[model samples]
Target: MSVVPGLVSITFRQLGVGEILALLRRTGLEAVEWGGDVHVPVGDVAAAKRTAAATADHGVRVAAYGSYYRAGDHAPADFDAVLRTAVALGAPRIRIWAGAAGSADLTTQQRAGVVGDVRRITELAAGEGVEIAVEHHPGTLTDTLDSALALYAEVGHPGLRPYWQPRLGLGPAEAVHEAGALLPGLVTVHVFSWTADGVRLALADGAPLWQPVLGTVAGASAEAGAERYALLEFVQDDDPEALVRDAVTLRSWLGGG
Candidate 1:
């Protein structure tokens, strides 16, 4: 019923599974969302299982499978592979992109295509007891809060959830608003700090923005009687030490320190 502090494995994509797990043990992060693009590729059941075992050995849980299954871009059969990988990895949820195109760039039919695919994948994942989380990112239908809410409404399936992050250049007030708006269906948050121009900064440097946003997310999670994660991603300079420092800052914000 509280927000958990965790990491997105792709933050250290260059590291092997063993190395990443070892790093997790040092950071005190409670969970990891393994990236399908690298650490746990789709259909790689052997790798998924091995990583899951290693994650458990390191005393961390699999938060979700960070899959690159862009809905509407691929055939429906493709999601089956993603779902299988997530199940093998013991991930309760699979994170997917809404679509490859930006929201405004998509026509009505294209938007419908994405929505239809999302609905299909949601049902497929639910059949396996896994949920689907749409990544709230640019160059996708979820680029804006209203667009994201609308997409969810169209799907209208309990199996579909959302992952939120502070959009580039968004101020604290706007970020807080977006987080609050997504709270009802938010599954996890990709935590990071970036300048308006996309320069990664230390997590502590973004405290003014993150503090209230995290507070809002925590409140919503408690109210919904559900646990969610604030997962760290893309630290300054892609440095493991930066991740460790970010973890400390995140834990303090979550009252875990």
Candidate 2:
């Protein structure tokens, strides 16, 4: 399968800071994301600044900040603070997770409250010149396409988009097909490996992993003429060398170095 040109930024939430960076080096991947749980905590100003410097020092792009801040659980001030830190990191997009970590018994009104909080934060994001990407991770606010779309409709701002993750359990084809509705509002894409628990399958032995995604994004960019980033979200596997090699595979498919 042919890959779209240009390397996609990626993040490994489970990997330690140095391990993640080392994986990036080994994979030849030039862009990386900060999973707030890992390298940089959301709203941590000093850490974010240091991360920004690391991006330059390593010659890799600081793609976005992945903050697993569920909707209503976070205070408005904290949400704003996190976005501000994202800006300081020179990242244009901040990735948000939409589920409650605890309290499995959330009431309907409670869910609604989460949505409301997200709307307000998104408004702030637009005002601050940053974009918010709601990751399509289920169980939170955006567990499904309908829910995610509803959030977008409620916010009604141009700065909010989706971080699509095509997965086996989510029906990869359906995720890919349903992406049409999200194409116009997409901040970035989260590529998947054919594995369980959001792990990164090895490049060579991996299922025909990246072809379909590359074809789809290439088609979308051609139609919209919008410059978008495909984030290679390697959820696990902390080998920098392998990570960089994976980037090479993607770039070769993308028709670039």
Q: Judge candidate 2 at residue 65 and give its lDDT.
A: 77
Model-by-model lDDT, in order? Answer: 0.92, 0.66
Q: Could you tally the backbone clashes for each prediction?
A: 0, 14
Model 1, TM vs. native: 0.98
lDDT of 2 by residue, 145-230 (tens): 77677767876778778877664555546656767668767756665465555555765434354556556766777677765565
TM-score of each: 0.98, 0.81
- Predicted candidate 2, C-alpha RMSD: 3.8
State the lDDT at 90 in candidate 2. Answer: 83
How much is 121 displaced in model 1, in angstroms? 0.2
Off by over 4 Å in 2: 1-26, 101-108, 196-200, 203-209
